[model samples]
Target: MGGAGNPDGPTLGGDDVRILLVDDEIDLADVVSLHLEQRRESFSVTTAIGGNDALSTFESTEIDCVVSDYEMPGMDGLALLRELHQRDQSVPFILYTGRGSEEIASEAISAGVTDYLQKRATSDQYAVLANRIENAVARHRSERARQETELRYQNLVEASPHAIFVHRGPNILYANDSVVDLLDIDDRTEIYGTDPLSYVHPDDRDRIDRRMRKAFDERETADWAGWRLRRDDGEIRHVESRGAPVSYDGQPAVQVVLRDVTDQRRREQRLEALNDATRELLTAETPEAVAQVAVEVVESVFDEPFVAIWSYRPETDQLTTLAVTEAATERAAAERNEPRPVDTVGGDLEMDVFAAGEPRVIEGYADHDDAMTEAFETVFMLPLDEHGLLSVASVEPRTFSAAERDLLGILARSVVAAFDRLAA
Candidate 1:
């Protein structure tokens, strides 16, 4: 037994539990504070003479628990409990009083009291109250820590830009907001409890499933680069994805993080293709030989059936076909003797582009010449300085994206350089 001035109590640890002791009677409050202070190793007690004073102390200080007398001149323990609940329900409150009644106990319970103790002089009464206070405070701290940890994890997941998913076996348990955007989904509920592999491209689904299973079974990690993921819109995008075994809902699950790498992969492939095409064009001895090499490389790299290179005749002011894909060789040969006007191509904007020395992309092929009729719905044309024109066509509409146009422009530049060397 020790008072605030006594040193007979246990030594306090670095992290001491702070407590607020409230009672209208100054003597009773002092006695309770002394008992708590005796456990100086665990508790640091702050005394409040009344409920109002207790409220003020609670606000200004960081208190772990509130121990209050039932009846006071200003506010009873029940009223104090109501006020405390309104402010924060997380702080543990215990009602310690000499008053006794089952109705009073029931009322305290209904008001959300953390613990109730009947005041007595049995010598061990304070010991029992002290135990109750310690237990309640410990539980509250533990729960608050857990909630804060969970909140932090949730915030991190929400803020991440990469798509993330949690899955058990094959069933998806959760998908973050970024996953919704990546998959073009309206609601997360649409993916919950569904197989995550369902969205993977059919060609890659089996491989991804195998990797996922191996990671889960062995509790290892797996990763994939340049894999295809088919979105809800049926468009396939390249992604670099990783998977690791994680705990979800108290069970072993797989956490997947996927990042779209379509543009990056395309750029890499385009660079490689351009290098190959430039190497081929560099070996040509004549402009016609350069056209043959350029058209062949473009066709092989793009996998398109329609590719042609025209040689500009300065005297005739015409662009005549020099090289054409075999599938369109007959059609191109028929127009070889004829000169297509440099100003316009099938009433399209290629005329302005030819004059401006820029690339022209016919996304819909709506204004192409008669020679291209029923041949292609999309066309990408770039002038090779005053040497000739390099054009690639696809039967599918809208096949010429910005990326494709840029890649072709690069190829045109290389071709123009080769033509200049030949003319030299």
Candidate 2:
């Protein structure tokens, strides 16, 4: 234990050490300050006359530790301890006075006082007082460090977007803030130490239970993807949950992280709906109708500005111009590069999309080859029933994404299906 030193003293960590002394007797504070100064201790000491003055001084100064008297005029030391505890439980408080009693000592200890000291007969006893203050300050620093570490851990768990949970044996001991928010629970207590499956939808519980059993028996990581968790509000949440064995409470436990895929699945459903509509148009009696439907589907569902459908003449097997709605606003940017009407749908590029049965994003068609630069700024081409390819041109470069490619493929499947229906 070390007593605080003078202000601007050489501290180990290059930070100032502050000690606050509170007592009604003005001479006592002066005497203690003088004894510590003579001892040449490493602390910056500040003095206060009474409880009111002590609290005011504490507010204005950075007091590492507080030493106060039990009996004060305005407020008692116990009340001060209670208030200080509320503000900072780690900051230590020492009670030293002539009125030391067993009852007072126990009460002070209960109220969060660090040390209780009795009045000494000789003035030299102030050295012992300084030593006790130092010990109190050291203990407070240790406690503050521990508290900060705990807070950092808690903040990490609470702030993570992925839901993290601790499950000991078969019970869920803790869930991160995201998990609580996902389950729509008000407090950690509501979710603690219960089987995670209790919150799982009945349809998914068996599979989840089996996975847990496998994890425990094999001591392997458990993966539970695409399960429905029933929320407190009675809504089912689609989530991907994973559990792995980790150390918790000095024993093996399951650590779980949950990722939400609700939006992804919703987008998939929308794609399917758009694909269904494209299928309907593909079967529409004639190639012209198929072209019109493809164009309409792109405009209506994809909200794309440009659409074109090319057809290869059955007799010649050469690409023939079908239908194209020249996007008025985007036309200038594309037209500037193409000196021609892009009238020729050459055999090589035409067969590429239809044969591959996949779409490609061509950025600056001119860069793809001098031949394509004639009419397209950027082009995404999807095949149509092996007869020809459906190519959509946009002035915007790289407008099509990977998901958009899947979307076009789905539309191509519908086109293939419609072609079969029309051929029949």
Candidate 3:
């Protein structure tokens, strides 16, 4: 080295760090190496005569950071930065240049330089470079870890089975695979940045909106169960969901996870309807009054157009209508006041249930009888033991599930018990 560094200057000593110093000036490079060597316990510095030499050194040796002169022969610092990025973008590169300018700084930044420092004649310049190198490397490591974490979260959300959505206020930012399937959507692009509340059922929108906003404001999680949602195809569904305040894409937002629970909710409502009917059945004074209340309770939980109760007299072997729903009364021309013997009526599901004293379920009733005047698509008949049978009819095909079958069976037993009590 041509000149010696000041011994009085602050020592650049701390944790051991590997640094690659690049400069074309052999004398300057030697001088800088000498200065760094004085603090050899803290820093292990290697010198490169130019950018090409720096690249070779980078490939062969492990380097925590690169400090290079912007103006150099053969390859410059900016070119060296590009080469280092192609090999490994994580290593920090600093442009310590004598020809410092706004244009150079901008160009170096665009080339992905970590830090820019102007060359000074003072011996303390090396100390400054040492500090800058430590900071730049620390920052780069931290950012890399953050990016890795975010990538992992993204992958998890994409593969989730439940409908997962992230929203800021009313606008939806992201949605998962299940959301597309639940909404019956072909493309996900249509969902981004749209108001999430627009997809909610008319009756449930306000409640969900309030919950989401409250969760965001409180910075806590909010859970909502048995919420109705209208799909893109205009069919209603139920969902249980939870929302929490989270940082998404560096912005304050709420992340929501929705689980489709339409089947579960329907089962719950059917149970509730059965309980309601049981309460009404216990208080009923007459069998006719019991039939009317049962029809009302069952009809409240189902989207059926018609419901009726028929009393079965074993002595006469006849089926007589005790009560009919309002819709049933409106649809039929005359009151079915004329009692018909079980053998006289056609051999349909209704007659079969009465004869066997077992429940009967029919799907697509029109298929069974094309000439059928009844507009209903599905029908169910549950025998009320020795008293009568309950009939439920829906305009939608295959509307009742297995859970409904079990629930309806329980309700039928309750009605029978109530009838036996009143008779005794």
Candidate 4:
């Protein structure tokens, strides 16, 4: 809806355009309906006895546009027009009356008449009556675009990797490049006059109709997510689809954006599978079961048994090894399962990390004494829960920098949050 001039639309015919015809002369209103029908601009034509009747019809039905004679009984076209504008200023209204003076034309135009025509004029003189409707349709589209562009049209379109398009009542007036390239399609002209759903997966057709109806009725954005779409080559892919109500060629249908998310979806599916497998392992009732799950998760993320989980003793300010799981080859007997005070091996490491109430990275084990260096090379102490740290250790005698510390912090927070939720 943004960053562009008004898109020109084809003439309106057999369109779902609701037009209220207001005239005291029933015969002239009938004649006008006949011509408009041929043009197919208005799907339904309603005849009113006067301005009052026109106003009543408008109140009852969802009128798309209005047409009225200047002179009428009870209320004149000018007065009715002022009322209509007050009710809804955006709706298009054309004045068709015997009054044709330049002064009246200017006044009528200023009064918000989309177009003005004299009843005395012959049919040939109003050949562009259809054109007038078409222009009003274009203006309506411009208005809609004006509102949407204020949000993020380019960003939304750019956000999607797939093609995007718009389908008017009977024409395809717009398309984005990625969509064009995906179908191996040539130009927008190739898809013009084509049924938009013809490319849609048959399974999604019903949903598409429902979505379209909701969007049209509410005048809001509509979307169909992760629906299967078929390309010209008969290839099908998962796509997120969206459409907005827009005037196409002086009529209404939809402006649509399509995105390809097959690759992203696939990655998500894989991640989900990995997470599920890890969850199943971690749910073990025994420490042995927990160790296995921990090993798998650590292996997937790091190179070796660089992970050591601890249970916190707040009173003693100590970290005791609850268990040790290794992904890489182990140098010590993990089965010994001996518990040691965290401060003994890494002086004040557990207390410092806990008191910090956040993640801390120890760059060099040598920064501490021999006991700390002998315990581990480099340690990233990330608080797993309220008091404990899930220490990721490296045997290479290194230090964890700010960047690594931040990444570990996020991961540790996730684990802590999960545990907190479980307890809650």
Tell me the whole-model lDDT of each prediction, alpha carbons only: 0.78, 0.73, 0.78, 0.66
**TM-score of each predicted structure versus truth:** 0.66, 0.50, 0.67, 0.38
lDDT of 2 at 303: 73
Q: Could you list the CA RMSD of all candidates, in the order they appear?
A: 6.9, 12.1, 6.8, 16.3
Q: In angstroms, how far off is 50's CA in candidate 4? A: 1.9
| Tens digits of per-residue lDDT for model 2, 1-424 | 1236433222234344587888899998888877765654466778899888888888787888888888888788888878777767778788987897899988987887889998878965676776677667766676677667656766887888998888765688877878877877888788787888887899999998887776666779986677888887888878898878765554667778898776577567768777678756754888677767777777766777677777767787667657665562246345566534545455466566666776766677745553344445687777676667777777656677677777777776776676667767
Q: Is candidate 1 or candidate 2 better by lDDT?
A: 1
Lowest summed lDDT over 10 consecutive residues: which window, candidate 2? 1-10
The residue-by-residue lDDT of candidate 1 on 368-418, one tens digit each, is 454345445677788888887887776667656677777788889999999
How good is model 1 by TM-score? Answer: 0.66
Looking at model 2, the pairs that clash are: 2-134, 3-134, 4-42, 4-43, 5-42, 5-43, 5-44, 6-43, 7-44
Error of 1 at 334 (Å): 22
- What candidate 3 gets wrong by more than 4 Å, as runs, is 1-64, 83-91, 155-245, 250-274, 283-288, 308-361, 364-377, 386-388, 394-396
TM-score of 3: 0.67
**In candidate 3, what are the lDDT values of residues 1-424, reduced to their tens digit?**
1023423333333445688999999899888777766734456789988988888999999888898998887788898888899999789998999997999999988888889999899978877776677677667666776778768877998888888989998788888888898889997777998998998888888888888889887888886655888888899888888998987776788988899988877788888878877888999999988888877777677655587788876776766778778776554433334332222222345656778888877778746753133556777888887787788877667666778788777877888888998999
lDDT for predicted candidate 3 compared with the true structure = 0.78
TM-score-superior candidate, 3 or 4: 3
Q: Find the candidate with the highest lDDT and give its number.
A: 1
**How many steric clashes between backbone atoms does each model show?**
3, 9, 0, 7
